[model samples]
Target: MPRPAIHQSCTKIVATVGPACDTPEQLAELIKAGVDVFRINTAHGKIADHEKKLKAIRAASEQVGSPAGVLLDLAGPKIRLGELKSEPLQLDIGAELTFIREGEPANDFEVTATYPKLIDELQPGNTVMLADGMVALVVESVSTDRATCRVTASGEVRSRQGINLPGVKLSVSSMQRNDIANAMWAAENGIDFISLSFVRSDEDVYSLKNVLKAHDCDAFVIAKIEKPEALEHLEEIVDAADGIMVARGDLGVEIDVAETPMAQKRIIQVCKEKVKPVIVATQMLESMHHNSTPTRAEASDVANAILDGADACMLSGETAVGDHPIKAVEVMSRIMRVTERNLIHEINHSVSHCVHPITTAVTNAAISIAEAIDASMIIIATRSGGTAWVKSKSRSSIPTLGVSDCPATLRRIQLFWGIRPVGIEKMASPAEIRAKISQWGKENGQLKKGDRIVFVTGSGVVEKAHNAVVVHSVE
Candidate 1:
């Protein structure tokens, strides 16, 4: 048997593209180190910068011969401090300050708020957190365009820093002009996924989908659940989007920090039940931003996310601006491989049975048959990648090889948990698919003599129905 084309791992890694890994060589190294998805944050860069990075990523992915996915993360209605009198304002405990609407210059004791309705939404006694909750403030009074706040915790506040108003629902459009433009750009550029940040409700997901449809872009949308209001309608939001990302940075500030862990678990559980991918993101490898190695606690956090059944773990500043971008991916991959080895059995048992759809039943059966026979591998031939995705949800110990004729489908499936996607020529029949899988498996060393393989594929000319499951032995 020959060696597999790509390294196989169960948990996916999402690395953000930024100055640290902007060049083609760096991007290629990151991909080789095990970055399944490249995320482009629209908030920080201009369109020209993003286009350059996207081109580099595609070139690097091609050089590596693995279809790496690109995710466009939009900046939703995120409220922030507009500007400071100086770079940073030092506030003492119990100091009084005023927050005025944008376009108004702040005095020494005042700061500008980005959202116009911030004052209207917040009332006396509402808590305001800045700089990821390092500094805290309590609203003492409010006027039409400004609010008086008393500093509860003293810290330095910088320009454009995020402001989190706990329990306050601001009347802002979920999809801003910039977000719509970014979505359109991503759709036109063949981005694999779009993450809508600060998603407050299911309606926000629907609204983004409508915008994408208008632009003729079918990129998968991942709802970033960071706002407190999202918890009330979490089920609807999960059902509305293709996936959910637990954006814990802002969430920790918006809600009690102690509640974030439970919230993360609940979000993952909901996504698991709906058969949609869930990404646990924000600060997983934060210390790696400056250091070449991550702390033990950070490694434990990544492992815990995998144990919690998250489909993927994301790195923000770690890979985007960290000194060790490639090393970060390597470390994350190593951690995932180690954790999956220990938790494979539990993972296989934890998957809930899918009873409704015929395809679901067929996919589940494929896993069951493979596990019972201790098959060497499960071969999934799919056109839209739906069959492979459903089969991956079972989390069988046996490796899953997803074969697709479409490069885009292969790239998109790279984000699916426990799937090693390979691109192949279009097959004419199930017999041809089996022969191809056999040849590929043998050449890739995925199968040797006497190794049993579970072959799974869908029926119908369009590949809509998963009606076939065959067990074959390598000759």
Candidate 2:
């Protein structure tokens, strides 16, 4: 019998690439440490550098015999201040500054902000937090390239620090020039997924999808929900997008810190309820950036996200340029393995019977068959994730095999709850499919003669018509 490639415990790790871990060899090390996905943040690196990293990751993946997915994160519609004599602008509590739509200096102490639509959204008394919320200013008046803002509170704003203006949703969409460029790059590079930063609504998802379609890229579009405006239309966004990312970094900046934990939990539930992969990102292992070890609280946070049904957790600064990059991934993988052990050894596992009627019906049948026969395992032959999705939505408390003809199916299915994808493809015949199932069982130690196993799959190649559950005995 053979072992499963990807087993239960619904936690996956995504590592960001940067100056810290850029080489092919280093990426191979991260992949070895169970980093399921790799992200290329175009916000920091050049396109050529990203292309080089993509090639490096591909070579390493080939060397390791597993296709690791690459995610390109776009620079969202970022409104940034113009150049300062020295950034980290020091201001008194009552100082005033000018924020403009143009990209130039306004005066000796004032500077233009560079987003064409910034002034359009500015309003009197509108609160704008500067440099990741280190400072706050209230809008007094506005013009095309300039706005008068009185310092509501003052603090240092360093170079390229993030600015957040909540309660003033921009009139324009969220896609930025960099995002357009990144989406084009994603299409050209054959990236698996494109994560849109600072997505504010379902319209943003549609806008990006339209762009991807224009470029003829079938890559999945994942909306990065990091704004309050994005939260308002979350349900629609979930429906429009293939996946959702709980981007806590900017989300926290835009919303109160005290509300963030509850918001995170809520978004996780929403994505789960929607049957889309939800990625919990930003500072999962922030301490790993500087230290060799993770805080107990951070480890617990990761575990909690897993229990909350987060399909994947992402590492930003930790993997991007952390001092202990590989170590960070290793730590996270260890955490996932132990957390899964805890679930299997103590907690009961139930398969999902997803929301769709057909999936629910097939899932119920699978569970009934499993219970009546007391089967040890179930085999699900799937493409496009529907078959496995049926098993996932079923809530069956047994080891399920997600066999797929496409490797992307295998990798993408990694985020599904209670699914372990075993890559196998045969276009021969039904007999061949059955033989491969048995062969897999025998090779993986899951199938033995007289053991009853439930097989879930569609009879033909009608991708979405996943409505068959065949019970068979291994012989």
Candidate 3:
């Protein structure tokens, strides 16, 4: 039997690139520690900073001999406060504050918001949350010029802090001006995935997709499920986007904090049923940002996400601004490995529900054959990476290798669960594929003469369709 080239765990790890791990050497270390995808957040940094980070990621990926995918996260329409009269404004319980429009005249107790129309949307008794729900206020009165809110939860707030209205229906476009510009930049730079923040509906996903299409970019658009509306339209959003991310940060604030766990499970279940790759993100190992080791509860969170059938787990501040970025990736990989060990038996029972009927049948049969024969490995030759994605959805315990001639396809499949993208130029024939696999396996000490390998491929017989499965033995 051949050992897995990149990893043994089925669940993938996505780490954000930030000041903590900006250089090529640091990024390479994280990749070597088991980071499958690097997320570049466009919220904090400038375009030039992100460009440099992209170059560093490519260099690091080449250094590690792995095709790591890049996820460019766009900052969607985020409602925030403007400059405050007092920096780090402290609001006391029962304090009355006025929220005026951006250009409205205001006194010490009156505040202005970045969204000029915020005052128009506020109603009496609406709950307003600020600084990621640290401060809370209940709307008391609304006039033409300003809305008065009584502080329900007292906390410190700074300029430009986010404001979340739980159930308020505000007239905000899904894709803001900054998001459109960032999406265009991502398209031009060949980002493997583009994640839109605060996606509220399938239309929101389509909005970003339309921009990408106009630019002739095929990068997968990932819809971030952060708002309560997104949960209501979850099915349609999942169907519309290429992937889903359980963005728990704002989601927890938008909905009740207590409902986040169940919501996370529901999102994962929906993605699994729809055969879309879902990433469980936000604070899986938050404590690891400062500590070298993660707390037991954090480890359990990561484990439970894997147990919930998430294709990938993401680290935000843990890897982006954490002091221990490399160690965070290592710890996350360890948790995934242990969690997957317990699911090996259950994994073989997974059935893929793919849109393509023939590809689904071929992938399912290939998994059954591999498990029946106890094959050393499963190799999938894919064109658009759909075949390998179907195989990955089946959750086969056997180590699977995804071979693609297209460079973009190879990079894109890096995020698929249980599929390791292997670089091979042309695997057009069975004899050639077998020889290449046997030679590479032997060189890597992954296989010997008697080991068996299963090859599933479309072979360009039909465009973007997989229709064949061949079982081969190592020579």
Candidate 4:
């Protein structure tokens, strides 16, 4: 068995792998740089490439003693111009552009749009965005085979530009053929997570869930809230996903650039409040893509993500193809640590504690006992955030963990202050809980074996109460 990762009081760093860091030595450098998880983007690499890198990453992890997690980001629902007629088409200003059907081929410029209905579905005067929202097109006429759109808003258009039809709003599913392949591969590989892209509704999550269930995959699903359709139905996505990712790259493309900041904050808040771990990603360190240092605004962006209750801040191009992959992690880690230390979760969740009579009584008793004993820590076995909030509201100056059988709970509790969250199965019995607590305590130096610790639980009918207390020795 390998050694475990070092203890960081709060927050984590997730690094993306790319051209710059594909080898074992480069990968080991990232892991050594305090990367909590490694992301393999299926969007760019072949399955063989990912397989080689995944093997290297895992081997490195085992060699180092403590293995980190691997996050396989599926190339979900990408709408791209397929097989361009030319590498660099002369997309002149005021010229008309048509998104051709899937089977069409041309010489100058022809986009084999995946959505066969896009041409027919779009109405005259609908706005079409391309190249990560850099270029804008307005539909002048619509036909079954083509939509005559002019470059009313001018910007550079490149080969394989991602086209977005905001007004057309054709019904598209998040699960694509490529996504199915990547997801299936990820599941069989013991990947810790599968990042769902272009998620629009709760049903999308449910649909992906069926695929995951079919493979008996225990991997957690992370919904990337980028589509405008997804924002309208955010709650349903939250309930379905184990966690969420604030994928700002495409999100900024979908919504106004000015609205990106506020929208990111909202997504983070909603995900956190649900006790799910939220990851704030995209351009977090874009400057690092070329230069080693990030701009002041970028620094603030990172700090704000941490303040917004994000459990992790992810690096995309920065660590993937940046001038300094290791430096990027170091800087991000420092920023997160500094920001977290200065900031606090102002929202008090204690007000929502409504419980049945017996559970309420047991909860009150636990709070009283926790306070009276001046305990070093308070632990709660709660599937819901209620039990944790009870202790939080009492203003207990102690570390609290919302222990849960659900991984979603662990991700969710990352937003609350002074709380360490983890996904663990039920302790089975009071004795088992005590035994595990004792082991964790001694190993972490929180308590010694002989030390007396007070344990609290809820009444039988309560949400997360056991109606008992036990004194155990850490051995």
Cα lDDT computed for each candidate against the true fold? 0.84, 0.75, 0.87, 0.70
Q: If candidate 1 were superposed on the true structure by all CA atoms, what would the RMSD be?
A: 2.6
lDDT of 4 by residue, 279-305 (tens): 899988889988889999999988988
| Model 3 C-alpha lDDT per residue in residues 1-475, reported as the tens digit of each score | 2223455467998999999999999999998899989999988878898899999999998888888899999988888888888787899999998998656445667788888888889999999999999999999999998899999999999888999999998789988888899899999999999999999889989999999999999999999999999999999999999999999999999999999999999999988877899999998999988999999999999999998889999999998899999999999999999898877533323333434667767778888999999999998877788888888887778988888777788889889999998766554565676688889888888888989999888446335543788889888
What is the overall TM-score of model 3 with all chains considered together?
0.95
Model 1 C-alpha lDDT per residue in residues 1-475, reported as the tens digit of each score: 1122346468899999998999888998988788889999988978888899999999988778778899999989888888688777888899998988656564778788778778878899999998999999999999887899999999998999988888887789888899988888888888899999988889999999998898887788999999988988999999889889999999999899999999999998888777888999999999999998999999999999999888899999998888899888899999998898877542232232322266667878888888899998888877777777787777666888877777778878878888888776665566776777778777767678788889887544234444789899888
Q: How far does residue 293 in candidate 4 sit from its true spot (Å)?
A: 0.6
Residue 322 displacement (Å), model 3: 0.8
Instruction: Tally clashing residue pairs in candidate 2.
Output: 18
TM-scores of the candidates are: 0.94, 0.85, 0.95, 0.77
Candidates arranged by lDDT, highest first = 3, 1, 2, 4
Worst 10 residues of 4 by lDDT: 1-10
Among these predictions, the greatest TM-score belongs to: 3
- TM-score: the better of candidates 2 and 3: 3
Candidate ranking (TM-score, best to worst): 3, 1, 2, 4
